[model samples]
Target: MLRIRGTIGDLPVDLTLELDDGDWARLGSQLQPAPMADAPAAAVAPVKQRDDLWQSAQDLLRNAGQLSGLELLDQLEGLAGDASAAKRLLVRLRHSPKVNVASGGDTPLYSWISD
Candidate 1:
């Protein structure tokens, strides 16, 4: 027996399914693991793009020398095309050895300190 209880678009839903031994055997057979295939090129492309974006972000900070958190976020958001992506890049920058983060009263100041 399988049971599911959830809400769909604010509507409550409950479902139950009962299966015999033969049915369960067939389902189990269908669920058997398949052989893994090589990863597709599309899957690898995003990683490269992310690396490029990271490099661009570093370059942006390097050129600017220093900027407030809000200011950096604005430029990164534009470069990344998403607020979440920008924030992620900001966090990555915070951890990078080439960048330094200092508290600037109301916001953090990001400065590029190349080694």
Candidate 2:
């Protein structure tokens, strides 16, 4: 048996799960690591800088399809290194014809507009 309790934003979450011996054995088999010879080497991630913020922002929306304004801003902040820069990126995205913004509850959702 396993138990978990956590919070997502203001919402509370509690969960309890029970597993029989057979279930545990099946799960253990699936969890086994692959042999090194069969595994592919991991590629290195490129370091992003402030100058790449524009392209990064575009790529983010392109891949995600849609993201809430707050979520977009949060990701921009990580790429831009500051809230101000993130705001600037937001404005650019708002003005770009390639992107569209729609109201989503408390925040707006930004989406890529494919032509």
Candidate 3:
């Protein structure tokens, strides 16, 4: 069973879905991965651990003193290789005890909350 409730623009939307055994099997089959050969083989680099991302984000904020969210996102994108990953990093930093956020014109400013 799944319940989805949200707003689309100003309109509210709600939905509920229940899947039986056959439905579950069909969904599972659709989610199966392609054969290995059909996939492109790229060199796999070491994954960046969460600790490293957190430390790097902290270092950036500490060194900058303060940065607008856009500026921080840009820097994080350079480090994380994509906007999505950078957004995740920004959210993590926003919740950290060592960081503080304040509105700065169009964008919020992030600063390191030092001990």
Candidate 4:
């Protein structure tokens, strides 16, 4: 049995899955690492786009020096063109070594850390 509990955007998700022996085997096989030689060339585009967005997000904070969580999220949503993507970028920023997260009353304050 597998349980997944999380939220997608404003939606809450609570999911459970039950698998038998055969299903487990199949899932395990699918989870195996693929060979580098078999990797799809077309998959690079999305990865490149994601990297660009990540860089852009970092730049946004660096330029601002500091911003409230809500302010940052709003700008990131505009930059990423999607709320979910923006939230994901924000989370990544929150955990980054170059950023500092501090509690600020009702929201967090994100500040860029200079090296």
Q: What does candidate 1's lDDT look like per residue over 10-95, in tens digits?
A: 99999999999999999999998754356677778999999999999999999999999999999999999999999999999999
lDDT by residue for model 2 over 1-115, one digit each (tens)? 9789999999999989999999999999999997866755442123244447688889988988989999999998888889998999999999999999999999999999985
As for TM-score, the candidate ahead, 1 or 3, is 1
Q: In model 3, which residue pairs have backbone atoms overlapping below 3 Å?
A: none
The TM-score that candidate 4 achieves is 0.66
Which candidate's TM-score is highest?
1
lDDT of 3 at 91: 97
Candidate 3: lDDT of 32?
Answer: 100
| TM-score of each predicted structure versus truth | 0.68, 0.54, 0.57, 0.66
Better of 1 and 4 by lDDT: 4
Candidate that scores best on lDDT: 4
Which has the higher lDDT value, candidate number 3 or candidate number 4? Answer: 4
lDDT, residue 81, candidate 1? 100
**lDDT per residue (tens digit) for residues 14-96 in model 3:** 99999899999999999999785675544222333656877888899999999999999999999888889899999998998
- lDDT score, candidate 2, position 14: 96
How are the candidates ranked when ordered by TM-score, highest leading?
A: 1, 4, 3, 2
In candidate 4, what are the lDDT values of residues 1-115, reduced to their tens digit? 9999999999999999999999999999999999867889877779989999999999999999999999999999999999999999999999999999999999999999996
